[model samples]
Target: MASTLTDSLVGRLVDGRYKVDSRIARGGMATVYLATDRRLDRQVALKVMHAHLADGASGADFVSRFRREARAAARLTHPGLVAVFDQGVDGETSYLTMEYVDGTNLRRRLHEDGPFAVGEALQVVGEVLDALAAAHRQNLVHRDIKPENVLLSTDGRVKVADFGLARAVTEVTSTTTGTILGTVAYLGPELISTGACDTRTDVYAVGIMLFEMLTGRQPFVGETPIQVAFQHVNDDVPVPSTVVPWLPAEIDELVCALAARAPEDRPHDAPAALVHLRRVMALLPPDVLGRRADAPPPVVSFAQGTPDDTDAPSSVGEIDKIDEIRVGGDTDEADGPVRGAGATDHLTQALDTRASGSTIAFTLPDRDRLAPATGTAPAVSTSPTAPVDADRPGRDRRRPRRRTLVSVVSILLILGALGGGAFWWFGYGPGSFTSVPTGLAGSTLEDAEARLDAAALLHESVEAFHDTVPAGEVISTDPGDGERIPKDGTVELTVSSGIEHFVVPGGLVGASVGDARASLSSVGFTAVTESGEWNLDHPEGTVLGLSVVEGESLPHNTPVVLAVSKGPEPVVVPQVQSLTLDEATEQLEPWTLAPVVVEEYSETVPEGKVISQAPEQGSAALRGDEVTLKVSLGMPFVEVPDVLFTPVAEARTILEDAGFKVEVNYFMGFLGNEVRSQSEAPGTEVRKGSTITLDL
Candidate 1:
């Protein structure tokens, strides 16, 4: 091991940039050091690979994979993920610089202060999930997800570290118990058996971590680490409440769903699990969310180790000496830790052995989806551990198939030797009909068909959209279970094809709301909502557009918002007829109605007063619609003719012809016909019917 004082890179600069400070921690593959970036002026955790890994037989491949995976990890930008800054070969030492976390790793925390309350456990797991969701979106999987890789900062933030580096190290890692067992403790069963994995593999590890958080231990334990790994393949994770009686059923359900024995049974990815967890969180009462469980005694973690400098791979051969396993809590009682001194005593990390470098590739088949105790694990071997052929599933598969074949053969032989009378009765007589089976609704299509075939009944399949039923499951049948049907009668089987989606039909953008609604209904989008806005280009109730694009697909009953036109907004024409023309114009303008003035004579109204309006006052009109205001000019006026010196009859005739009433007055008993005086002044404007006095 390289001592800090004797460390070649300690207190020295690497790659003309990072200044290595003190060593923080050491892992199986690399040594983590606190370092300062001269250019960025920030502290970073520098993970420098050992010399032998850079100079070993497969050195080039190791370097290539290391740089590639590092680059991939750098693409992940999320608050909950430890940010990868840079990766390069500093001469003989290959290194990676990452964001420096200021707090303890989850493994350390769990050892010291975990077995968190359900709420706290849920919160921490939720944060980890949020971080994984970012990687899932980028199509990158974090092959390793144990507590050791989860960094909890002092500021109450959770982050995931070491993305994609596991696969880089797997090809060259030793396969011995020491190299595999410690790291394999949390792996899903499928990864162990088939060496295939996807995002779900990570989900399984998180589920185990969550279980540990809730109960202070992983779900399985054994005499040897291999026994513990086999427990995952053979047994199901027991309910959490089985250990903590106070835990609600929902918590058990959540843990089981994430860590289901079958990979298909678990959530598809971190986001899905996150969604389910939040739902459970929402349903729990405030007290439960706020409650804190009693704390266990802090287990001591590994002391900071001296950096390894020897040519050998660090910690690989220590697994051959394994014997008995002792744990913090009773190993039998539902697989959870009970509170006690050395609550995690023998297994501070359950043998957190630091190796030169090896990791399980997590090459788990999706058919899925992990440790031990010890003294401080001693020096690890660098020799590559050959892969073990522990094909547990294949070894177990034959028993079930043989049992099924024997059962089928036994049933056939007994039926074939039936007496002729009995055979006739069943095939062509009274016993020809069979009763349908019950409890088939949730069965897989294949399973349901097998049951139906046993009944000797003919059946036809039909696919339909179902909101709650999973795909390829029996939804319903024409003749329900337990109903008697003829042997040859065809039963209509409605199978769920999973949640159905419909493409938003074309041409809905310009159609009427009614037409659009009908079109959507025909295609299974029945949950349509109409949102209206005043529009000049479209008629009232015209469909303007949809919430999604025209051809986009959406699930059953997903809300489809119809952006419909409400025509132009209706403008209420105020009682402008009785108002003055100026007042009418001012009131009508704000209603978005355009006003037109029409001047006309009125018998009683004063001039400039609005007499009447088109479409009547207070009637509805579209915005921008024209509203004509008939303004009044009062009574018609006529100029009084000059009647001062005219003859009395002539002046009277002139006044009458000009629409003025005339009255003849006698001057001094008898007046001259030619001379007259008018009541109204000559050429003066007056109401047409006003009386005019004429003197004769």
Candidate 2:
């Protein structure tokens, strides 16, 4: 029940192989830890099912999924995949042991900062596709490929996490009726519409994550999880270029294709998608391969009237109070009885005052308690205490009965006079001069307010949050749309605040460890590293993976770490001399060697055999090296002279003496048939029996 680290079951070894070191992250169904592999002397990420999920009713399903995922993920041997080392139960706890990646999640990066640079965004997307390619090849779909489930190692390699785990969990709890597991923001359209998926589902998620990274916003949004899910099924994936304007056209097409509403429209699988992604990335200029140094810092414009000193907005839990006023007087009965005009405002003000300065719960070093606000109260606040004036009746005491009756009669007489004034005001006064507009259409609150304000009417933005209305869109108007009201009367509006923003995970694909750290610091993410992969393009010491996708909704200050990648491995080209061409090609295959051959005459070497090589035996070369070989053509031979520059009588006599072939050319007397030019000079050495080219 306790969310604090001291009370949680952290620092305990599970299955005697993994020693729980610290909490890395937590979600609705599980808590993940950065643990050490005692036997292997390596670190790993251990995800333990939540106690509620490990209950007898769901335990079988959880265990089955844990095992199924191990089987499926283990089949995938790729640099982009997060390896599954082990999965088992330690007493009552069920956990999965995977390669511990050390890096921030993409979600934390976006939350700490705003948007990712175009280069960094592309890198993340491309790496994720690389990982997905491996999974899809194995016929395994990572049903949950959100930013939270994609981890970046310290070396900037992307390792996909939670492959098939969500589907396994779903299969485990078929009886229980509740929302299926997975973040709403990154769910693929097919998953939302049909509950059917393949590797393309993950591609869709990768597209969504890329969109968020580039634009610092999700493509689809709603007030409720259901509405957001519906948006996936019905709405087109909004282009991030529309939001950022600087995104490249190729990238825009790639993203749009990945998130197509219909599955048939998306890439066939992750591998195919990766091919497209790589092709698109290859087309980008070299300068776009890394973070752009010239990009100006994003303009920091806080909403008008927002406090100057408030900490940057964090996750949903960090937000203290939200006030959503109903527009107009069309208060629905379902909203409960309406309070007096000033009463509602007073309550909101009180909550706002308390929330204004409250401290947010942050992550810590303990495993099992890595997430902030794991549905528990803060440790610092004390229990409520009774006030000292509890028993006093000073205000409740009434005057004498005769005085009360006289006061009631006098109030009645005054109310009658006010009733007459209200009737006149409604029937004949200027209050009847104007009518409220019927609809705001699709106008943003800012535009609506400006238009209404210019019309000399009062405009008040109601801070109501709805599941359907986009942020800053007017939900409704005051006095009801189309209702008649007095000129200069207030036109109240219920504007959306949009879905609550959360910390972006640090380990986005392609981000370096330092970049991840900067991003987390900016967004307020605090998760610790657990494991990682080694990649060359990203280099070692950069973030390579994350538990969540970027821009996912999660608790604040989750402890995330940068999983660094090990740069590409350098291999020496193998020796291919003295071997047959086939044998040599096979031996050098591992070195990525390219073989080129040139035929030359050698005194001692046999024909069709290798004589010498440019890079001889033991000569070092990198993979993909081109090596030239000299093949033997045996000893050189020459033919006798074939002269053609002599006169017919002189040529025939010379040919017989030199043992050469000669042909005579006849010409008119003006152009004498004398020796003009010879194809080959006399006595010159030439290959045996080769025809001599002649010209007259």
State each model's CA lDDT, in order: 0.68, 0.58
lDDT of 1 at 416: 79
lDDT of 2 at 290: 55
Model 1, span 72-109: residue lDDT tens: 77766567777677998777888888878777667666
**What lDDT score goes with residue 404 in model 1?**
92
CA error at residue 121 for candidate 2, angstroms: 1.7
TM-score of each: 0.45, 0.41
- Which structure among the candidates has the greatest lDDT? 1
What's every prediction's RMSD, in angstroms? 24.0, 24.4
Q: After superposition, which runs of candidate 2 have C-alpha atoms over 4 Å from their true positions?
A: 1-4, 164-181, 286-696
User: In lDDT terms, how accurate is model 2?
Assistant: 0.58
